[model samples]
Target: MEYMDMYKKWLEFDEDTRKELEGLDEKEIMERFYKELEFGTGGLRGIIGAGTNRMNVYTVRKATQGLANYIKKQGIENPSVAIAYDSRLYSDRFAKEAALILNANGIKTYMYKELRPTPMLSFAVRNLKSTAGIVITASHNPKQYNGYKVYWSDGGQVTEEHAEGILKEITSIDYSDIKTMEFDKAVDLGLFNYIDDEVEKDYVELVKGLTVNWDVVERVKDTLKVIYTPLHGTGNKPVRRVLEEIGYKNVYVVKEQENPDPNFSTVKYPNPEEHEVFTRAIEMAKELEADLIIGTDPDCDRVGVVVKNKEGEYVVLTGNQTGALLTHYILENLKATGKMPENGVVIKTIVTTEMARKIAESFDVEIMDVLTGFKYIGEKIKEFEEKKDRKFIFGFEESYGYLAGDFVRDKDGVIASMLICEMAGFYKLKGMSLYEGLMSLYEKYGYFVEDLKSVTLEGIEGSQRIKEIMEMLRMEPPRDIAGIKVKEVKDYLKGIGDLPKSNVVQIILEDESIITARPSGTEPKIKFYFAVKGKDNAEAKDKVKRIKDEFLKHVKL
Candidate 1:
């Protein structure tokens, strides 16, 4: 049917949706109805409005119906599912809609009673022995966006095989054939079960148990001055509970952003990767004379940190810096205490800093680099568990995602915050701070710096231009960047190492710097990631500017 006919059908919607539709002009209608919102491997994400291209009850119902069919195919004896939602607008409504559709199809759903983080949903899937899990969140996207993500029974985001199977079901099923049962009716029939309090307690305990150095935690539990902000999402309760329960008495919460607000009115963007999101926490840290500040994103899967530098001023550490620091901290403690596993392994994404490799080698541990995404890291954990050759210790991406244990297959900001606090406390006991510890690592590992630049080209033309840019680079590979020789190029689409095929390119320079270019899987943007090591910070900064400027001249973006 044409979007005009669909527009007329929307007339039967509630007053609010009807008003929105009535206000839209022709161009607005075209943009909203140009194409259906895609169901990518990770799942669906889009602006919340009234159209096939938007995220709404209709899209939720259609996607859930597809997922329900896929779940039935898994052939579990009981075949139940776990459902969770964040603090996004209509997230609760979407969760209920998914539950009702699953129940309508005779599959049971364990839905959270309130908003929860992404990692919790992953844990809930395995804890309940369910067929799969659904998370109604867009991670750290802006206020107008919401999303649907799926996790398999292994507690990881669905792998490629599962995603392909689900896509087949989604494409074959017509939107009209999607069915839904009323939420109340499903509950009364015992098809929808609200997750109990014990489940949350078990998850918190699981995180607490993953702490490496309890002695260090106890030594500075009271003196560890830390500030945390959830950025108006789902991290408020669990993050605080884990910290306070672990005996961090001096922990302070950014009171203004502690509660859930769909608008995220306090910050320009709710992403933890953006330094501006820590504005409120930085202020609170300064007033309280805190040693460290932590900020989690909307879903609490990514965390950002601010620590007092030697100059007695606070500085926001980039994700690479924090990952390297944490890597060193975790490994040093393991080796120092004789707890380091003989076959220990640490995993990082391709775009992450190479300082990880240096740290792992210093401990005589193996390092694995997967394509971008925590799911790949999770895949390695499952592989190691089966092979029984290596023990998983730490995993992280350059995008502020990190995982230490296999309890959750995705990044756990809750645990990452705890570990960072503990790491800081250990440094404090040694008469230093995390910032000073980071600088020490630089001194040991030579100065390593990274820079990422994203060129967002939205809509149809932007996408075409992105393709053209990638093709241009592939066809005419750069022989030199900023007078530095390009040693070789690795195209991941043809498969690299033991990794699966992907549309990513790595330009290895003679100086050992790495330049990676890949299109964003979910959004309409192309990102360029640069990594370089130098004798000091200034040389690294200069190298980045020269390489990036030369690279951009070839793209015409």
Candidate 2:
């Protein structure tokens, strides 16, 4: 009945929404209005459509109203917000709607003049000293989806406590109570302002400054052939500019994917994690005889890489692989240049490869393992600032997200791409490819491989099934997986030692092999992560497969 009410309310919308909903079947109507689009810790994300469960102007305004109310309660005199959007459909419109709604609620808004990557929004929040920030992007989700991610003045995703407060405020307000002003009126009233390119220049300069050895890059600038693709998102301009200005003359952009396209015409999805997203870039690399390829997701928060093996075939690197390689390079360079600190630390998620730990230890740098999300890593960065106990060297997760500096609290592809190019250049100077660099890391550390498998469960019933699966695993926990004895079980929900409580479980084997299961916070899926190390590459991969196959038997997929 509630869904039916929302369906009726949404039908009173504009002509396009009304016409779109007029012909929906009963199932379609229920699917679109069964419940409000979830505003989780990640903020609002959903398929763009006409109902309460979809991402539309009404929902965006409602969320903004809630955020405004929360800000007012914080007692910040004349609070402000920074806003940015990506190339997704309706992203710009949603961003403008949010800004105006904030303006109507008596808050100043600093919005980007055009589409930009998510990390820039993070930087803008701190640079502009705004009360909060919002970026309209779904990250790497399909084209049907768009999102609104909120960040505090710290330039990181809103804290869990903040998420709860905003949610309470959101629930108290009715959809009809949402306020907004015209864009022109907001601009005239001095409540709305556009951020200029100077901020971009500042951001690019900071990224370029992260280069470890520009001397090597300059030497290999003309010889190192690099291919890059933005995946039709927001990374094209900034990434290209940073590389070019930093002295890479042989960089080639994938022409077909260089510009914004909401449809993501050439790939199944804009996710760099999927090999399919690199088809165009790989072709360009092979034709150009490039040494390396890089691709970033839609919002450019996460990045992926491809490198030529000794056999001259392009091999895609997993997020863990890239993170490991970058870790080794950064630490090695720091020590060589005598910039290594006594208290430097490397942070990674619990599900990431243990190779990061091994690599950090080899360099005598401490490795800190946080919870799965990058926000926890960001929280640690904030903690480091207040305590000044440890200096952050690098942070990454298993999902292609990485960060080297604390200038931006979130994962940054712009900086990651720049460092990756520098790393490749450093290797080229030694007559080795990035693949051979990875091989050397494995040679020193044991061979480690990781795999991630996701089982998507959609709709109301599917959500229930997901809950059931999780409960079963917790109640009857696996004693052993694939003949390896279970050494210990870490149930993150019960609140691990110092980490926040989360709905995730990990079974550690006697051999130190690890398996983690958790429901995705941003999508309707439960992801399983397997990490194992063995004497060689084939053994490591085979152990992962065996462990994954055996673990799936315990849960109903």
Candidate 3:
């Protein structure tokens, strides 16, 4: 079995791996070797280390070999892959290892020399017309973590079918069976190529083209003071360039967190979704009297925002709020410029706030819902482009990921950052802050409050607990919660609504609130999503409280 085989490999490992194996206790050893680091639908993601269950050069090579084989099986001539890396520890090394494996298989490689964002890698896939692409970064995962994401020729994350096929090849192949070559020799053979600054240049131009209100941005550039932080990731250069190119003159960067650091020394977590990630940026904003602050995660696919409310205090805006704000800005500007399409479509994750639907309806643009994950949004964008049915005006999720225009298939924080700055300036010219804009939307569309929480359960016992939770919900559906009747329960595993099968459930309450529960595929956790609407903020808060309390009580986890 692979378990003992990997244990034997550990025994025969080189100096570093042998040391790592010796350091672990029996339980740790089993945990590390009981299973290979799964090449899941999202590719290989785990703690970066020596074990088979961790993301190391060996594991990365194995995944890449599988990807290369898949490309070869497609019978595409001169197959090539584009690779990029973030600033996480060993990310660059892992990326190079992947390229080496792909090169060993006669697949050409186009790689960025320095760290870049996930979205940039997506752009590279389309720009180079590569057969597939790879990015080595954990996104917002903690310092102990690192990841390798694979994208197809479609410029989107590999879909379910491709991932599963590649995973089969990865899982069946022996660890030593993965092919690799010396980096220098690969380069000499022209199998490994470096993507030049031209990619970054074109990427910036592409994102700038997504801007909705350039004239308004220029008008308010000088008067509007803003703070931006990349949180030590790939967003620094591109984000700043787009803002500067669009006439954001008074933009200020948080000096302390400007450069990339693998440990994310300034904050415990590098995720923009967390308010603490904006600590230094917030301090700088207050000192500079900036009206708004924006931050992006390490890989730069997600953006978080902070705005000065009417009370003059800086408050973090939820992903839902930011999505709604961007949706409003883009639609309003399009209509103002007479660029609104009669059948433009906006896309959001099914779990994202319904407020987006209401906003799209107000603008007469059709809004469609997809399963969670930005790849679905990208899938729709590709579909629209192919069918020529409806134009994709915007795509977003509740986790701060957003995309506009068809340039890049993935959610792009670089573009989101530029547009948010421009949107803030548009309102500042009218003597209102971003908070005011959000409040106005709430007033117009009722208060649609949303919340998300993850309950982590680790290892073998923990997985059973997660399974129990899902089974419990399916076997005994709740008919009422806090006196709110349940209207329907949609088990996504049964393949509901034309979406691919997944382990998710959407519970629609009688009052139209939604509660979704699903086990996270990428982490050892189960995520719960809540979206509640009410007449006012207070009422929304109360309903959220009651629903969450009663719902959790029913689950009894």
Candidate 4:
């Protein structure tokens, strides 16, 4: 159908919705309707707009109906699902509509009474033994976006095979025939139940158990000055509650971003990975002379940290650096307390820095590299559960997502917040800053700097352009990058990489610098990850700048 025809369909909508659609430009309508919102391996995520191809009530209903149909086909006698949403616009309504649709199909639904983090929804899935879970969030996306992430019984995002099955079922549905009942009627009929505070309490208890050195926490609790920001999302209350419960006395929340705001009123982008997002928190930290500044994205899945470097200037650490610091801190503490597991494993994505692998090997802990998503780490937890041979220690990705324990299958910023504070306390006790500790790690394990660049390709044409770029790169793999001889190439989509098939490619240089390219599974963008190592911080900084400049030249983007 033409975009103008879709615009006419929008005109047929209710008066209020019609007015909203009419106000949008032709370019906006074309972008929204040029292609249908896909059910990829990461589930559904898209720009919020008025079209069957965008994330709206109609699309949400169709997705729910498809998931409902899939559940019925699986022959689960009493299918039930848990639904939760974050603080994004329309998230609550979307969650309720999804629940009502599922209830209309005779499926039981457990919905959160208020806004909740994505990890809580995962926990609720297993706690309730529901067949599936739905989280209405775009994770770290900007305010104009929203998403629906599906989770399986194990509280992990659906695997490729399962997602494909669900996609098939979704495609089989006709948008006009999906049934949706009134939210109040569904609640009255006993098909919808609101989750209570007991679940939150249980989740808090589980996080508190992940603490390794409560003695240190108690000793340095009052002395450690910590600053935290939730970036105007769901993390504020939970993160603050957890830190307080753990005895962190001087924790300060960024006041402007403490409350949930769908527009993310303070920051240009809600993502914690960006340094600009930390402007407010950094200012507050400077005022308080805090030891560490921490921030979590909207859904509270990824975390970012800023600490005073050796030069006494506050610097934001890359996700890989943060992960390395946390990994080293956790392992060293465990060893000091004689709590190191014999068969422990540190899980990370293939694109993550090799410095973490080196650090893990030093402790005699196994490092397992999986594909990009954190769900792969969750899958490993399930594997460890089935086979008691290996123990899961910690997991992280290059995009600021980290998990210390298996309490929740996905990344929990609440857990990361607590552990980061504890780590800061331990370093402060040693009279060193987290940044100094990071430099010390680099001094001992070689200085490593990692950078990620994403190229956004919007709409249908953009998708094809992304595909063309990937194909071109695969066909004409770079023989050398930035005067460095290309030593090896790992092609993941062909399953012939040095690792496995993962829709990623890694290029090793003669100087041992690394570069990897992969299209993002969750968004309409291709990512380039660069890593360079040097003997010291100064040399590493120089090498990183040169490599990053040359990398862009090579990619010609």
Candidate 5:
């Protein structure tokens, strides 16, 4: 159907809803109804509006109905699904609506009493032995955006096969025929059950088990001054509780952002990747003379960190840099304690820095590179568990998501926050700042600096433009980037790379620098990842600036 037809349907809503739809202009309606929300590797994410493509009650109902249909066809006896939501706008209502729809379909539902992180939802699905799960969250998207992510029985986001099946069911559903029961009626029917505290306790205990050396944590617990901020999302209570339980006494939470605010009142973007999100936290750290500052994105799936350099200036570390630091720290500590597993593997995305691979190699650990999604990492962890071939050590992506263990099959900012603080304490005990440790790591390894640029393509036309640009790049590949000769081109779409098939392209320069171009799955954008190695810190910094400048010149962004 045309967008105008969708717009007319939206206008036919009841009084209040019709008024709301009428308030929006033609552009708003067109943008909302232009295309259906896609189920990519990241699941469904979109702006909140009154259209089939938007994330509203009707869309949620349809998605839930389809999920229920898929579960029924699977022939699982007494199939149940777990549901959870974040602190975003209408997340609670959406969660309840999803549960009610599933319950009305004769499927059991286990939902959290309140908002929770995405990882907790993943854990709950496996703990409750449910056939599937739904988390009403957009991870770290801005305030205007929301999403719904589905998970399989193994507690990982639904993979391609499962997603395709769910999409088929979704396509077969008639929007008007999808049934939804009242929340109270669903509760009375005994099909709805609220998850209890025992699950939280179990999750906390599982996270505690990820620790390699509690003694190190206890040694400098009081001495290490650390600042943490959840960026006004679902991570506040759990992260703080974990830190306190693990014996970190000097942890300080940013007061301004301690509570959940759907608008994310303090920052323009709730994402931790942007340094501006850490402005207030950095100021607080400066006042307290703290050694480390940590920030987690809204859903608590991604974490960012800043540390004081030797020059007493705070430097926000890239996701790859932070991941390398944490990975090296964990593996080295394990090796020192004689606990390094011979058959251990580290997982990362193809766009992530190769420096992590180099670090893992020094410890004789294997590295597995996957497409740009944590679900792939989770899938690998599940594989390792089943095959008993290798232990999953650490998993991270270039977008500030990290996981230390298999406790939860997702990028967990709660655990990442705890581990990052503990690592800071480890360096504090050695009479060095985290930044100094980073420098030392660079000195031992080579100086590796990585950067990323995202180009947003809005509206329907923007997507077509993105496709045209990718085709142009593929057909007429750049021979050189910034006066540097292109040594190799790895096109993941054709599966011609060090890894499998994906819609990504990597260019290797003569200087050993690397550049990757890939489209974002959740949002309409194109991302460029650049990595350059230098002999020393000065050389690395200069090369990063030069490479970034040259990259912009070539891409003209």
Candidate 6:
């Protein structure tokens, strides 16, 4: 349909939608209806508004109907779906909208009574033995964005095979065929049900059970001062509960950011990876002399940490630093307790720090590399479960997402927050803060530092420019980066090893530094990931700057 036609069609939906479209001019109408919001492997994400290109009730309904059709095609007995939502604007309404649509198709749905973390939705899919799951969240995106992410029975986001199938079903759907029933009517028919707290209890128990060093925690539990902030998202209750249940006595919550706020007024962006998100938490930490600070993003799937260095100044730890520390802690504790699996393995993305590989090697464990995205790690976990040859120990991406256990096949902030607090306490028992603990690791493993830089290019012209840049790099590859010889170039578009094909290119330098360039799957940006090893922090920082500057010089943009 043309933009004007689609605009007219949307106006026929209802009064509210018409009102939303009332003031839109031709340019605005074209922006809204030029194309349908894409349903990719990770599902739909867009600005919340009334349009075919935006996230709204109609889009949600159409997606749900397609999902229902797919479920019916599978022939699973009494197929059901598990639904969860974060604190984003209209998240709850979207969840309910999807549930009613599913119920109208005679497919049952179990939804949370209130907001919950994305990981809990993953767990609920497996715990309830449902066929699939949906989480209404935009994760760390800005306030104007919202999304719907689809998951399979294994609790991992749908990969290529499943996503293609779902996309096919969705494209075949029509507006008239998308069905929905009254929420009350659906509930009375036993097709709509609320997920109870017992399931939440089970999730918390599993996270608590993954504790590595209880003795260290017990010794410093009383004196381990810590502060946490949820950034006005869904992690407040679960993160606090796990810490208290594990006996952290001096834990404090940043009061202003404790509750859910859709606007996320405290920060410019709700992403935990951004240092600005920790402003309030850091203030509380300094006043209280807290040992550690933690912040989780809106959906509670990613966590960021802050700790005091030897100079008594608070500094943010990059995702690589945190992952390396966690890797060391989990491996060391396991070996000490004589529970280290003979086939244990740690998984990381191609863009993550290579320090995890060194830590795994030191402990006689294997390290596996996958494409970026926690779902690939989750996919590896499922593979491990089915193969029985490799035991999944831990997995993380360089984007502040980590998973220590297989109970939930997603980056779980609830579990990562609990483990981080415990790690802090464990080090405190030895008179060392997390910064000291990290330095200790650097002393053992070579000093490895990683940096991520993104260039945002918006709208239609920007998309073409990004594609051109990637093509230029692929066709006319750099001979060297920062005066060093380029050892090899791995183009992921041709399919790297057993991984699926993707539009990514990785350049390996003679000095073993790695530079990966890939367009962001969820955002309109191309990201450059650099990993370098140096004798110390100074050299690493210098090498990162030189390589980053030289690499950017090649791009015409």
Best by lDDT: 6
lDDT digits (tens) for residues 348-391 of candidate 2 = 99999999999999988999999988888999999999999999
Off by over 4 Å in 3: 2-5
lDDT string for model 5 (1-557, tens) is 79889778867766655777886888888887777787755668888867877888888888889888989999999999999888888899989999999999999899998888899898999999989999999878889999999998899999888888998888787777698787788888889999988998899888877887788987988778889998988888888888888878888989999898889999998998888989999999999999899998888889999998878888888898889989999999999988888799999997888889899999999998998889989999999999998999999998999998786899999889888988988888899988888888888889888878889998778898778777766777778876778898888889864544777888889998988889888888998888888888788778767777886676656
RMSD of 2: 1.0
Q: For each candidate, what TM-score against the reference?
A: 0.97, 0.99, 0.98, 0.96, 0.97, 0.98
Give the alpha-carbon lDDT of every model: 0.90, 0.91, 0.89, 0.87, 0.86, 0.92
| Candidate 6 residue lDDT tens string, 462-531 | 7899999899889998999899999999999998999889999999999999999999877778999999
After superposition, the stretches of candidate 6 with alpha carbons farther than 4 Å from their true spots are: none
Model 3, residue 461: C-alpha shift (Å)? 1.3
Give the 10-residue window scoring lowest on summed lDDT in candidate 2: 548-557
Clashes of each: 0, 0, 0, 2, 0, 0
Better of 5 and 6 by TM-score: 6
lDDT of 3 by residue, 244-291 (tens): 887778899998889989999999999998889888888898888898
Per-candidate Cα RMSD to the true structure, in Å, reads 1.5, 1.0, 1.1, 1.7, 1.6, 1.0
Which parts of model 1 have CA positions greater than 4 angstroms off?
A: 1-18
- What digit string (tens of lDDT, one per residue) describes model 4 on residues 30-87? 7776666889768888878778678898888889898998888899888899999998
Backbone clash pairs in model 5 (N, Cα, C under 3 Å; residues 3+ apart or in different chains), count: 0
lDDT of 5 at 37: 80
The clash tally of candidate 3 reads: 0
